[model samples]
Target: MKTITFNQKETSPIALEFDELIPDEIFTWEKSDFDSYMVPIGNSKFPLSNYFDVEVEGTAESPAEVVMIINGDLGRVKYIGAKMSNGQIVANSSVDLHCGAEMSGGSLLVNGDAESYAGREMTGGELTIKGNVKEFCGASYIGDWRGMTGGIITIEGNAGKQLGECLTGGEIRVKGNCDILAGIHMTKGLIQIDGDVTRWPGGQMQNGDIVINGKLSRSLEGFDYQEVITDPTISGKSFSGKYIKYLGDIARNGKGNLWLNAEKNRYLL
Candidate 1:
């Protein structure tokens, strides 16, 4: 695999956008070409040579053959690898917003936290975040009906509000807690939360699956209480506990499934 490394020389005084430097566009560029490049910071473009040292090694016939490594504090850098079709990207630090928006293929791994709109409108591939993420993780843009169409996002830590909103396809597995309205308006897909939920999950979902294994602070009145079942199979995975099934977002005539843990949330029984 071809590798491109970015080592920070100085942290950006203004936030930089690294969306344009993905494997799809820079696969053919050499180290010298990278040295002369300028990355967009806020509203202006600054010479990338001023912030990080660049090194591009090996050769690739396609973006899928390339591997991009960003090794520095990227908490102020937004859009690290947005809309990439094929490649392997690894960010060793926290990243700003839109980390993997509208992506079609390949894989992206953020070793730290990510801001809002991570994995928005993604059609295929994988995005893994090792730390907590802010709002709108795997959500669609405002007024849009479809969010991620394909792909898988696994957040190893807590996630903010509106996770996987308006989702069409794909899967999101959050190992930690999540804020409100998770999987809202989802048309298709699967969301698994291993931790507690704040409130109103699957608020208006038309069709999809949301499995909450932990406590739920509140549930929407739009859902009708279905019978509790044991060893429920959600999205092809058998969970070894009793679950309360709910149907409707009756407000939208939605038939999506919201499975809440009966053991953890016994008050609702």
Candidate 2:
């Protein structure tokens, strides 16, 4: 893949917005083009070169043939790959909010933690985070009824609240622990939590599947207990442990499925 690299030289006190610097828009750009480009900061715009040194190598005819790498601290950069439809992005350090929101294709790999609204409203593609993510990861934008209509998000570390709130489609896998209200109000999709969950997952969910493989600290009263199954298959993925399944966020007349590791959540039995 052709590569475009950005090495940070300075950080602005005001966060920089990266919505205009995505691979989809810059695959054909030369170093000169980037040198002349401006990035939005708060209500003003400044030349992007003020913060990073740009390097471009090789050539590409399409966004899919390119790779963008951001090296150094990007903790003040937002919308790292928002609305991108193709290509790949690798952020080597912690990133600010909306890192991969509204993406429709390609892949995003974050070597460090991401702030809230990561992957919000994404319709396609894959987002992988190596560290913890804050609230609203893979969730709908506020005031929007639909969230994450398609794609896959894999978080190697813990996730904050509302991991997939109001989701309509796609898959989210949290390899580590997650906070409360994951998959809440979801209508379709799959959420797998490999580590412990705090409380109240799948609350008010109308339809969808949530598999919690670790200890559940508490269970909500909205779900009705269902029979336990050995090595249950959820969303085409087979899990080896005995699982306790429940249905409903009955308070909302929902029919979502919540599966918990039977051994870890025996208190709910």
Candidate 3:
């Protein structure tokens, strides 16, 4: 396997764009190639060597054989692994916006917090975030109708608003709290949240499933209450406790399913 390591040496006020540095594009690049490469920052370009000490090791015939590790403060680095088709990327610190936006394949593991658009419009692969994520963690771009169409996003920490906005496919599992409108406008997909939700999940969803294992602050009137189920299975995953099912977003004539833990949401019963 080929390994590439980037250790941050300096911090930039303007975010350094890294959409061109994925394993698919740099699997065969030598250290010298990285030294001469210019990185985009704001409206200008600068030597990547000025901000990071790069090390390339081993050989690879394909992008799937590559592994990239980035260490140190990368809070100003944008697009850490955007549009990658294969390979693995590990970031050891908090990342800026668009961390894994538009990725078609491969795996990205962020050891710390991630900014907005963590897995926007992803079609395949896995994205794991160890800490909290801001707004639009797995949603569509501004003015775009398509969101994450495939893959899996696992968030160990809290998620902000519009967690899976406009989702057409894929799955999102949140181990911590979630904010409002988790599956708003979704057409197809599954979202599992293990923590409390602020309000209004599946607001305008047309077709999809949202399973919330925690308490919900409020539910939208657009969803009509359905019968309660016992130890229901959702999207092939089984739950031990009873869940209350609801269907609607009839405001848009949606047929999405919303399941909430019966024990946690007694008021809804």
Candidate 4:
């Protein structure tokens, strides 16, 4: 296996892009290669060594055998693991926007908070955020119709608005509170939220499922309340306790499912 470590030497006012530094592209790179590499910042490129002290060890013939670790504050680094197909990446500090955009495979763990667009359009792999995510956690890029086609995203902290906007596939789980429009326009996927939601979780969704374990502050008029179910199994994941099931977004002729905890949402009854 190969291990590459990047210790931040300095911070830049403009965000440094790390999309090219993923294990899929650098698994065979030596320490010398990193020393001479240039990283993109805004419209210009600067020497990567100017911002980070890099260390490379071991060897890898494939991306799956590589591990990348970034230490220190990376709040100015964008696309930290974008488009990687394999390997593992761990960020010890908060990250900037587009942390794992378009990733097809591999795993990325953010030990701190992340900015918006954390996992936009990812088709495979896993993304775990230990802290809050601003917005659009697993959605598509702006103006794009297709969103995450596969993969999983688990947010330990709260999530901002439009959490799974335009989602086409895959799954997202939020352990903390979530903001409005969690699965708006989603076609196929599963979103499970263990904490309270602000409102309008499955608005305009054509097909998909959203399971909320916490109280919902508001319900959209487009959804029609259905019967309550006990210990439901949704998208291969089972949950205990009674849940209220509703189907709609009928405003758009949608047929999505939204399940809310009956115990927490007595106001809906």
Candidate 5:
């Protein structure tokens, strides 16, 4: 596989956008090509050569044949690899907003954390974050109803608010805690949270499933609770514990189900 590396020379507290540096692009680019590249920073684009030295080795016949590696603290760099259709990208540090937005194929791995919109509107591929992620990790853009058309996002650490807001397809697995309004307004998809949740999940959801394996802080009044079911079948998979099913988001006339582990959440009883 072809490799491209980005090593930061200076930290920009203002944040730089690296959406143009994905493997789907720059696969055929040479060292001088990247040197002549201008990356978006704030409202303007500056020479990427000024921030990080460039190195390109091997060759890629297509976008799917390339791999990009970015190393350093990218907390101030946004859109690391947005709208990529193929190939692979690996970031050694935390990245900023839109890290993998609209990705259609290949894989993106972030060794550390990521900012919001990590996999927004993604049609395919896999996005893995080793650490925690912030709000709107896999959500739709503001005023849009379709979020994450396809793909898979695995978060090893905690997640912020609206973990998969307005989700339409795809799957999101969170291994740690989550904040408020997870899967809000989701029309279709699957969201599995293995840790604690703050409140108001699956709010106004029309369709889709949210499986909570941990304690829930509160339940919405709009949801009507059903009987406790043991080892219930959800999304073609069977869970080992008791679960409470709530159908709601009635304000939108939704019939979606919110499955919360009964044994883990005694406070709602």
Candidate 6:
């Protein structure tokens, strides 16, 4: 793979948007090209070279052959891999909003935390976050009905509210705790929460499956307890536990499968 590295020189006063510097667009560019490239700030444009030292190694004929490494604190950078169709991006520190939004192909790895809207409306590919993510991760964009039509998002840490809201396809796995309204209004896909959930998952969801392997603080009235099964198979994955299955977001007259660990949610029994 052709490797390109961006080492942060200094933190910017305002958040910098990285929608333009992704491998799909910059894989063939040399250092000189980056030096002259204008990156969008809040409202104005500034030379990309102002914040990072660019280093390019080898060459690539296509974006898929490129690997972008961003090393340093990018807490003030947004949209690190937005809309990329192919290639790989590794952000080594916590990133700002929209880190991997609308990506159709490619892989994005955030070694640290990510802000809201990560993987919003993504159609395909894989996104892995090693740390926690804020609200709306894998959710739909504002005013958009479809969220994350395809792709897989694996978060090694917690996730905030509305995760996978309005989702139509794909999968989301949160290894840590999750906030409320997960899989809200979702029509398709799968969501697996390995830790605790605050409340109200699968709210108004019309279709899809949600497997909660940990404690659920509360359950919504929209669901109807279906039955209990031992070692239930959910979304083609075998789960080793006594699980309570529920069907509905009946408030919307919808049918979605919600599985909760029976031992952790005995109150629902």
Candidate with maximal lDDT: 3
TM per candidate = 0.96, 0.98, 0.99, 0.99, 0.95, 0.98
Name the 10 consecutive residues with the lowest summed lDDT in model 6. Answer: 232-241
lDDT of 4 by residue, 1-269 (tens): 99999999999999999999999999999988999898999999999999999998899999999999999889999998899999999999999999989989999999999999999999999999999999998998988988888999999999999999999999999999999999999999999999999998998998899999999999789988889999998888889999999998898888899999999998877
lDDT for residue 248 in candidate 4, whole number 0-100: 85
CA lDDT for candidate 4: 0.94
lDDT tens string, model 3, 1-269? 99999999999999999999999999989999999999999999999999999988899999999999999999999999999999999999999999999999999999999999999999998999999999998899999999999999999999999999999999999999999999999999999999999999999999899999999999999998898999888877888889999998999999999999999999988
> Across residues 172-224, which tens digit of lDDT does each residue of candidate 2 receive?
99999999999988999999999999999998899989999999988789999
- Pitting candidate 3 against candidate 6, the one with the higher lDDT is 3
Cα error, residue 10 of model 4, in Å, equals 0.6
Better of 3 and 5 by lDDT: 3
lDDT of 5: 0.88
Candidate 5, residues 53-140, lDDT tens digits: the string is 8778898899888989888888888887789888999999988888889989889999999988899988889999999999998899
Compared to the true structure, candidate 6 yields what TM-score?
0.98
Regarding lDDT, does 2 or 3 come out ahead?
3
Candidate 1: the clashing residue pairs are none
For model 6, how does the per-residue alpha-carbon lDDT over 13-42 read when each residue is reduced to its tens digit?
799999998888988899899899998999
Would you list the clashing residue pairs of candidate 5? none
Each model's lDDT comes to 0.91, 0.94, 0.95, 0.94, 0.88, 0.94
Candidate 1 differs from the real structure by a C-alpha RMSD in angstroms, to one decimal, of: 1.2
lDDT of 6 at 211: 94
Off by over 4 Å in 5: 267-269
